[model samples]
Target: MKKLLIIGFLSLFFAPLAQAQLGIKGGLNVAELTGREGESSSYKAFYHVGVFYQANIIGPLSIQPEVQYSLQGGNLKSAYTNYDSQLHYLTVPILAKLTVGPVFIEAGPQFGVLLNANQSGNLQVGFTEDGQPAYGNESRPATSNFKRGDFSVVGGVGLKLASNFSLGGRLVAGLNDINDAKNLTGINDPRLQNRVFQVYAAFQFGDGRR
Candidate 1:
């Protein structure tokens, strides 16, 4: 089913070079991992970049399919230490877009395949609270516990600045757990999921009206 969807999108992507608009986009990601054992998840900053194709189905309505490479993760701050984990994925989103003048809104399902993941931060091995050795602090690379693929839903709004340029923002919420318990990282939550807020600018080729 996933393969068929990708293939269909690709056909839409290449149907007519003159009729459809192609765009390149890059963005900032504010990511957080939810469903923790006890610790509160903090936001981590990352980035994403990709290409997309837009095809109009009717007035003020369109379909867009995008392929993006994204960096996502979360931060953990505790009484003894702090940790930062980064996960990288290749993602695709197929969106139904609606426009009103210069403003447009979009909603869609996104799919991702994990590329890589890692963590690095300061950790307390032992602590000294009362003039005695209680906790030790050291910097090291933490273990990674990540799944191979991720499923998510995305929604956003954008405003067209001109015929060729636009500014946009979106939220992506993971529907599946991106953590693997088999590769247990004692520092990370077992049921890790992705939550990201993205801000982006898009540059489109050819003159396409919104």
Candidate 2:
């Protein structure tokens, strides 16, 4: 059953590419973690680059599929320590777009495969005799403690500035828990999920009707 499903999905995904416009996009990501309790989380700035295929299905409507390399994660701060979690993913989003004039709105489901995860920051070591805090820098591999896959929903709006150039903004809301650790500090659940806001620029080729 899974094999059949995979084959059908792949067929559906690729069928429109032959008639699609190809484009390249790069963007800034402001990402953070959600669903945890009692710990402060902040957005971490990152970037994504990718290519997409878009095909018009009917008047004012289109389907777009994209593959992107994205850097994501968040900053966590506690009373005595600060940590930055960097997670890397290869993400695919199949979006349905509706256009009116030069503006467009898009929504889609995104699938992500985790490539790597890392943690870096300052750790509170101890205190001086005078009660000043002392700290040390730390960095380590964090891949083992995170899930290998992520599912998300994306929604955005954009404007077509010219025949081949456009600018857009979007939000990616993760649907699953990414944390897989047995024991980890500063993470109390509902589990950790990714939340990201993105601003991007795109250039389309092949007749420019994207």
Candidate 3:
């Protein structure tokens, strides 16, 4: 937790260095599992509030590094089971950005440090206290002991409008495992490593820098 605070502090301190740009972004995200099979297909809304720094290396090429607090996960349901798990990650991505006229594209890898994770749901089995068909077991929220992942891919596209404000979308695909539990069901795959997609609008400061 201390390291997360340090990263967050550095993100703010790097704003005024050189031609660094600061912006606010908010968007919807679609999250799901990848790599292995048998995992359920699900989508969830993920949003992040953060800042970014852009340093131009060439005419139309720049490197933008960002730090964000993101929420990502999915809802799963089986024949007799229903549950939902969400992951809150402090993600950092270093992207290579390209621009042409008003359109721009970026792609890079991201590292996600898990902040908090929880599972909540109610199991439906037989009947309720009233004898009618109802939820079997009451929902009990459980915290997760999740470890941080190494690397992931971060890429997206956007358009610059009037030089100061821009609109874009990006996706973060996790490559490292997030689960550290001992499996008894023979499922060795990690559950915290999921996919996140974001669409946001940015307002760049320091005019004539776009």
Candidate 4:
């Protein structure tokens, strides 16, 4: 994990050495941790802002790498009946970029290390079908336990205006399961995972060149 972190940083640092340019990027993330079917999950909105460096490795093709502190994952539902989880991570993505005229397309992999997590909503059970209060046992204890080092795939597209500023959207989907337990009381419940979609504006710092 440490090695992967090092590599991601290095990729960002060296990308500028080869016809690379720096940029500031920020986005809106519609994030959620997906659970089993019929579990009823909802996603929340989070924000992310970070800087990136893009290196043109070949004609119309480049390696763009970035390091960003991202706010990801949460639920938006009744506090007493829903689970809400938020995670902060420094993410590094190595992307392959393509440009045609002013439109740019990018796809890549990202590695993230969890910096913090918080429990903002309460968990309850036996709520009525309409989410009304009801008398029943709390389904499970409130849990905040999760793991660090999440790996995922990120891909997006952008439009470059004046070759210096861009507007784009991206989606981040986690590859590893976020659940730390093999089974909750040996119930065989499947693990949950992360997924996020982002839309934002970006500014390139240098003239477009290879």
Candidate 5:
């Protein structure tokens, strides 16, 4: 079953490559971590840049395959301290798009490979006798406790302006836990998943729109 699925995906991805419109895109990401039981997670601002191939499949349908470098994670606040978790990923998304006039809707599955992770901010060390919190600045490598891969889903809407430029917004939701160290101490949650909202502009190097 897996082999057949892989073969089908490969066929879909590569079949349109020869006649596709090649484009480059760059975007801002408002990213967060979800599924934290008690800790609060806030959106962190980051960026993504990538290249894609889009081709027309039928009258109002198309296929797009993209390779992107995305920075994601969140600002986590707990009772004791607040910190930023930064995660870097190389991601690929294969999308099917439906276009009506100038508007397009797209949805797809995304696969990501984790490149690095880090945390920076102040850590609460103790409480003073008067009940004030004491904090110390800390920066460290946080990659040891996270999984190397992430699976996600992507959905978005965009506008096709003229023939070459476009604008879009997307929501990406992780489908699996990214935490790999269940036994590690001081962990806020045993399961951490990625959540991101992206806004982007794309330019195609072609003469006409698909």
Candidate 6:
């Protein structure tokens, strides 16, 4: 009786750890920035590539961790200026996924570190009576006028095929303000926050399942 109890305890403790999965993934990111009051906003196209792993903790449920390179920010046009601000970040996300047969859905929070940034566009030089640029062809070289860190919320769904390949789409929106808008005049406060839509394909390794 004592030996049987010990065996049962060990099996229960190790069951979840034995079912973990890991995979390699890459994808496209359609990104933009929103929330600059009284200004017009537009989305930009970029690339997002990364890797992910899942640790199954219980029946049909798992914890997923991902690391990826992401492009963020957006284009804005106001009366005085029109430009695109590009930001690059190295980001990590911790997700909780619920798998049901061939389909799974996940949601989580992501943290990111800024890698680089730059701005290019046209800025008007004089007063506008007819909404025309008196002096155009303006540009700002690669600089760090924004913050160094970012945080976002992510959610997505996927379908598993042949226990090997999977296809999915995800939406990530920023929770913290990404723009510092430092020392620059005429730029609005709380100027920008990021938003992205991702479509990805991944292949599972090891046992051909995850």
lDDT of 4 by residue, 27-51 (tens): 8988998875445667888998999
Q: After superposition, how far is residue 186 of candidate 4 from its true place, in Å?
A: 7.6
Model 2: residues >4 Å from true position, as ranges? 1-19, 123-136, 184-190
Q: List TM-scores for all candidates, in order.
A: 0.80, 0.83, 0.76, 0.76, 0.84, 0.83
Model 4 TM: 0.76
Where does the lowest 10-residue lDDT sum fall in candidate 1? Answer: 133-142
Clashing pairs in 6: none
Cα error, candidate 5, residue 96 (Å) = 0.5
Compared with the true structure, what per-residue lDDT tens digits does model 2 show for residues 81-104?
788999999999999999898999
Candidate number of the best TM-score: 5
Summed backbone clashes in each candidate are 6, 0, 0, 0, 0, 0
Give each model's whole-structure lDDT: 0.83, 0.89, 0.72, 0.76, 0.89, 0.82
Model 1, residue pairs in steric clash: 126-134, 126-135, 126-136, 127-134, 127-135, 128-135
Tell me the deviation in Å of residue 115 in model 2: 0.1
1 against 2, candidate with superior TM-score: 2
- Model 3 ranges off by over 4 Å: 1-17, 35-39, 123-145, 183-192
Please tell me which predicted candidate would have the highest lDDT against the true structure.
2
Which pairs of residues clash in candidate 5, taking residues 3 or more apart in a chain or in different chains? none
Candidate 3, residues 129-168: lDDT per residue as tens digits?
A: 6765455545443334456564789889999987788899
